[model samples]
Target: MKVLLGISSSIAVFKSIDILRGLLKEGVEVQCVMTKNSAHLISPLTLEIISGKRVIIDLFEKRERSDILHIEITKDADLLLVAPATANIIAKFANGIADDALSTIFLASRSPVLIAPAMHTQMYLHPVTQKNIEKLKSIGVEFIGPYEGELASGERGIGRMAEPEEIVEKAVRMIMKKTLKGKKFLVTAGPTYERIDPVRIITNPSSGKMGYALAEEILRRGGDVILISGPTHLQPPIGADIIMVESTEEMKNEVIKNLEKVDAVIMASAPADFKPKISLSQKAKKESIQYLELERTPDILEEIKERKGKKLVVGFSAETSDVVENAKKKMISKGMDVVVANDVSKKGIGFGSDLNEVIIIDREERILSTGIKRKKEIAKIILDFIEKKLSN
Candidate 1:
C-alpha cells in the first residue's frame, strides 16, 4: 500500500516519525510531505532517511520529472493522511487554499483522507476550527482523534494527537481490501454464567480476547458485526452492534434471535455446560450446601443446526486431549463448516491469555494449525480463510 504522509506545524509533529515507521513496518510505502512551518519543528532529512523517500517541502522545488509534483504524488496513493494537523492546515484544506505542497496535495488527491488534529484545546474547540473540520468532513474526509489528554502547553484538554499505534491501525483499516463489504457476521465472545443462586454462578476463565479480536478483524475487513458477548472486562470493538448477556440461556436466545440477520455465525463464546437443577431464590447457606444437583444447559449449536441452512457456522472447542480429532468430530456433529480447537491444558496460552495455538478443521476434514501466536494474528488467519470460502 502507498500513503501520502502530510505533516503540519504542531508540537505533536514529533509523533509523525513513529507514524511513518509504523506504516513502514506494515509494508506500506510512504511519501512524506511537510508544510514549511513544520520543518522548523522537525528536520525533513530525518523523515527522508527513515522513509527512504526525499521529503517534499516547497511546491516550486525542482524535481527531475517534469510532471506536476503535487498532482503526480497523489495520483497513485491509496490514502492521504495528515497527522498533527494544525489549525492553519485544517483551515487551508477546508477552504481549498493550496499555498503549500501538502495543502496542494490535499486539494488534488482523490483517495481517502484521514486527518489527526493537534492544537491548543481552545483553538480546537473554537467555532472557526470546528467549522473547518465539519466542512472537510462533509466532503468525505475522516478524522481520527485530538483525544483528551495533556497538551503541549502542559494544560490538559481534548487536543492531544492520538498515539502512533492507533493512527497506524486506522490507516491500515482504511487501505485494506474491503472483501467482506456488504456482509454481516454474528460473533459471540466471553464466558456465559449458569446461575447457582442470585449471588453465585458457574463460569469459565475466558477473557474474550479471541472473540473480540475476531470482531475487530471482521470490522476492519468491512463486515458489519453483531457481537453477542458474555460478561468480560474488555472493551467492545468500535462499530460493532453489541448485545450483553449473562446466562447460557440468554446468550442462546440472543444468538437465535439475530441468527437470520447475519451471513455467518462464529460461536466463540464458552457458555456453561451445566446449571444447578434448582436455583435458589436466595443465596444458599454454605453450611446447608451439600451434593448440589446439576442439569445440562441448552446446546446452542444443536438448536441452531437446522436453522443455519446455507449460512456458514464456525465453532470453537477447548480440549485437553485429542484436540484435532475432537474438533473434527464436533464439526461433523454440529453441522459446523469450520471448527477451531485448542489445548487449554498448556501454560501461557488460551483462557485468559492473549495468545493461542489452535488446529483449524473444516467439514471436509482438512486441517490447519496456527502455532502459538497473538489472538489478533489468529483472528486475521481465520478471517482470511473465511474470506476465501466466501469468495469461492
Candidate 2:
C-alpha cells in the first residue's frame, strides 16, 4: 500500500510523526507533504528521516528527478491522508485553493482522501469551518476526529487530534474498497460475567479483541455495525454503535432486541455456560460457603437460530477438544451459516491473547483454516467469507 501523508500547521502536527511510523509498520510506502507553516512547528527533516522520502515543502522546490512534485507524489498512491489538518488547510481544500504543496496534492490526487482535523475548539466549532467541513463531505472527502481532550492551550474541548493509531486505522479503511455497504451487522464480544455472589462472578478469558476486530473490519467495509459487548477495558471502535452488557442474560436480551434490524450476526462473545442456581444476596461468609448449585445459562445462539428468519448467523466455538468436529456439529445443530472454531488450549493464541487460529466450517461442509495470525488479520478473512455468503 502507498499513502500520501499531508501535514498542515497545527500544534498537533507533531503527532503526524507517529502516523508516519505506523504506516511504515503496516508496510505502507509513505510519501509526506508538508505545508510551509508546519515546518515552523516541526522540522521537515524529521519527517523525511521517518518516512525515508523527501518531505515536499515547496510547490516548486528543485527536485533532482521530478518537476511537478505535487502531481508526481500522488502517482500510484492508494490513499491521501491529512493528519492534524488545520483550519487553514481544510478551508483551502474546501474552496479549491492550492497555494502550497499539501493543498496542490489535494487538488491533483485521484486517491481517496481522509482528513483528521485539529484546531482550537472555537475554530473547529465556528460556522465557517463547519460549512467547509460539510462542503468537503459532500464531495466524498472523509474525516476522523478532533477528539475531546486536553489541548496545547491547557483548555479542554473538542479539538484535539485523534491518536495516531486511530488515524492510521481510519486511513487504512479509507484506502480499501467497501464491500459491506448498505449491510447492517450485529457482533457479540468479550466474556459475559455471571454473578455468583454480591462480588464474585464466573467468566472466561475473552479479551473482546476478536469481536472488536470484526466490528472495526465491518466499519472499514462500510457496513453499519452494532457491537454488543461484555465488560472490557478496550475502547469501542469509533464507528460502531456499542451496547455494553454484563451477563449472558443481558447480552442475549440485547441481541434478541436488535436481531431483526441486521442482515448478519457474528456471535463471538463467550457467555458463561452455567451459573450458580441462586446468586447470594450478600458476600458469602467463609463458614457459610459450601457446594454451590449450578444451572445452565440460556443458549443465546440456539435461541437466535430458533427465531431466525433469513438473517445469516455466524458462531464461534472456543474448545479444548474435538475442535473442528464440535464446531461443525454446533453449526449444524444451531442452524448457523458458519462456525469459527479455535483451540483455546493452544499456547500463545486464543483466550486473552492477541492472536488466534481457527477453522471456519459451514453447514455445506466447506471448511477453511486460517493458521495462527493476529486477530485483526483474522477478522478480514472472516469478513471476506461473510461477504461472499451475504452476496449469494
Candidate 3:
C-alpha cells in the first residue's frame, strides 16, 4: 500500500523518520512530505533515504514528470498520514487553508487522512485547537495521538507524539475497512491483587497481555473499548479507556458500572477467587499470624450477567485441568455467550507468556480449538468468533 507521510514543524519532527522506517519495514511504499519549517529541524535527505523516494517539500518545485506532484501523490495514494501534526497545520487543514505543499495535498487527497498531533499541553488543550480537531473529525479526518508525557518544552502533558509503532498500527487500521464501527466493548485484564494486610496481598501471574491484545483488536476494527486493568507493567493500548484497579471488588464495580454502555464484555482478568475475610490495616507479624480466614470475592462475570441484558458476555477460563469441561461449565453458570478456555499448565503458552492456546466454546456445544499462537493472533481468533456470533 502507498502512504503519504506529512511532517510538520515540531521538536517531534525527528521521530517522523522512525515512522517512515516502520512503514517501510511493513512493506508499505512511503512517500515523505514535509512542511518548510520541518526541513530546518531535520534534513529531507534522511527521510528520502529511509523512504527511498524523492521527498516533497516545496509546492512549486519542478518535477521530472509532467503530472502535478501534489495531485499525483494524493490522488492515487492509499493513505495520507501527518506525523507530529502541529496545531498550526491542524488549523490550516481544518479551515481549508491549503497554501503549502502539505496542506494543498491534504486538501486535494481523497484518501483517508490520519494526523498524529504533537504540541504543548496548553496549546493542545486550547479551545481553538480542540474546535479545529472536532471540525476535522466531522469531515472524517482521523487522529492517532498527542499522548500524555514529557514534551520538549520541559513539561509533561498530552502533547507528545504517539510512538512510531502505535502510529503505524493506527495508520494500518485507518486504511482497512472498519468492521466493528459503532460498537463498544468492555474488557478486563491482569491479575487482581487481594490485600491481606498493609503489605501483603494475594494475586495470580497474569500479565494482561491477552486483554490488551483484545482491546487493540477492538480499536483497530473501529470499536470503542473500555479496559479495566489490574496492576500490570504493560503500557495501556492506545485508544482504550483504561481504568486501573487493584482488588476484585474494584474491577467488579467498574465492570458493572460500564457493562450496560458496551455491546460486549470480555472477562480476561484473573481476579483472585478468594480474599482474607478481614483485611488488616496494619502489617501482620509473620511469626504471630495463625491460619487466616478466606472468603469468596465477588464473582464479576456472573454478577455482570444481571446487568448485561441482550449484551454478549465473553469469559476466560485459565485452568490447569479439564480446561474445556470446566470452562464449559463456567460458561453455562456465568451466562457467557462464549467462553475461551486455556490450560495454564501448558508450557510457554499461558500466564505471563506472550503465546497462548485456547478452546472457544459456544452455547450450542460448538467448539473450536487453536494451536499455540501469539496472544495477538489468539485475540483475533476470539474476536472473529464473537463477530460471527454477534452477526447471527
Candidate 4:
C-alpha cells in the first residue's frame, strides 16, 4: 500500500522512524511530510533517507518535477498518517485551519486519514483537546492510540502514541473494515449529574469509555460520528464532534439541538435519578449537615423517545444485579429500539475500565451478548449490530 506520513511537533515524533521501518519491512511505499515545528525535533533528511522518498516540508517547495501542485500530489496516496499528533496540530485539523504543510496535506487528502496523538497528559485530558478529537472523528478520520505510558516530561499517563507496529496493525484493521463507509451516527454516553448546589451534585460512575470506543470503531469503519457525552474523565475519540454537558437537563438540551440529520442516537449517558427540589445559587456547605429536598429529574431517554419521531434510539442499562431482566424492562419503558445491558457488579467489567462485557437487546427481544473484551473490540461488535439493523 502507498502510505503518506504527516509528522507534527511532539517530542514523541522520533518514534515515527520505527513506524517507517515497519512499513518498509511490510513492502509498503512511504512518503513523509513534516510541519516546520516537527523538523526541529526530527530532521527531514533523516526521514527522506529512511523512507527513500524526498520529504515534502513546504506547501510550495517548487514541486520538483510533478505537474500537480503539492496538495494535489499528496492527495493521491492510499492513506494519510499523522504520528505523534500534537494538540496544536489536532486543533488545526478539527477547525479546518490549514496553516501548515502537514495541516494542508491532511485537509488536502482524499484518501483515508489516521492520527496518533501524543502530548502532555494534562493537555490531552483537557476538554478542548478532547473536543477537537471528537470533531475530527465526526469527519471520518481514524486514530490509533494515545496509550498510557511515561511521557518525555517524566510524568506517566495517557498521550503516548501507540508503538509503531501496533499503529500498523490498527491501520490494517481499518483498511479491512470498509463496510460502512460514509455512514453517520449520533452517539451519547456517560453519566449526567444533577446539581443541588454550585459544587454539590449527584452522578453515576458511567465512564463513557464504551461510547468513545464505539465512536472510534465507527470512524475505523469510515463513518461519521456525532458524540454527545455527559460529564466524564475520558476523552472522546480523536475524530468525533463532542457535545459536553454536566447535568441531564443540559444533555437533553444538547441532544435535542443536534438530533436532526442523524442516522441513530445511542442514549448511553446515565442521567441523574433526581435533582434538588431547590437548586442553590451558591455552593451549599455541608458543615451544617442539613436535610436536602429532592425532586426527580426529567428522563432524558424517555423525552428523547417522545420527540425522536423517526431517529433510531438506543439506550444503556447498567445494573448491579439482574442485568438482562432489568435491561428488557428498560427497553420497553424507555422506548428504545435497542438496549445495551451490562452487569456492573462483575469484577473489571464496568465503569472506568478498558474492557467491557455486554448484552444487546433489541425491541424485538433478540439478545446478543459479547464476552469480555477491549472497549474498542466491543464497539466494533456494537457497530456491526447497528450496521446490520440499519441495512434491514
Using all chains and alpha carbons, the TM-scores for the candidates as numbered come to 0.86, 0.90, 0.77, 0.62
Off by over 4 Å in 4: 1-13, 17-176
**Candidate 1, 303: how far from true, in Å?**
1.5
Computed on alpha carbons, the lDDT of every model, listed in order, comes to 0.93, 0.91, 0.91, 0.82
Q: What clash pairs does model 2 have?
A: none
Q: Which stretches of candidate 1 lie over 4 Å from their true place?
A: 14-27, 39-72, 125-127, 145-166, 197-200, 278-291
Q: What is the lDDT of residue 1 in candidate 1?
A: 93
Clashes of each: 0, 0, 0, 9
Model 1, 1-392: lDDT tens per residue?
99999999999999999999999987899999999999999999999999999999998977788999988998899999999899999999999998889998998999999999999999999999999999999999999998999988899999999999889989989998988999999999999988888988889899999999999999989999999999999978878999999989999999999999999999999998999999899988888888779998899999889899889999999999988888888898998999999999999999999999988888767788899999988998888888877777
Ranking of models by TM-score = 2, 1, 3, 4
lDDT, candidate 2, 165-200, per-residue tens: 999988877776788999999999999998888899
What is the per-residue lDDT of model 4 for residues 1-392, given as tens digits with 9 covering 90 to 100? 77888898899999999988877765678888888999999998899999988888887767547664556666558888888799999999998888767887777778888999999999999999999999999988897789899999998999888888778656654554577676777888888878777887788778888888787777777778888888788756766888888887888888888888687888766778888788888876688547878888777787788788867788888888889999999888888888899998899877888888999999887889999988877887887888888778
In candidate 3, which residue ranges exceed 4 Å CA deviation? Answer: 21-29, 35-69, 76-78, 86-104, 117-173, 238-241, 305-309
- Residue pairs of candidate 3 with colliding backbone atoms: none
Q: Which model scores highest in lDDT?
A: 1
TM-score of 3: 0.77
What tens digits encode model 3's per-residue C-alpha lDDT throughout 1-392? 88999999999999998898888865789999899999999999999888888899887887678888778788779999999899999999999999999999999999989999999999999999999999999999998888899999898989899999999988977775588999999999999999989899989899999999999989988889999999999989888999999999999999988987899999999999999999999999998788889999999987987777899999998889988899999999999989999998888888999999999999989899989988988998999998888878
So what's the TM-score on candidate 2? Answer: 0.90
Which 10-residue window of candidate 3 scores lowest in summed lDDT?
169-178
RMSD of each: 3.2, 2.5, 4.4, 11.1
Off by over 4 Å in 2: 25-27, 94-96, 110-112, 121-141
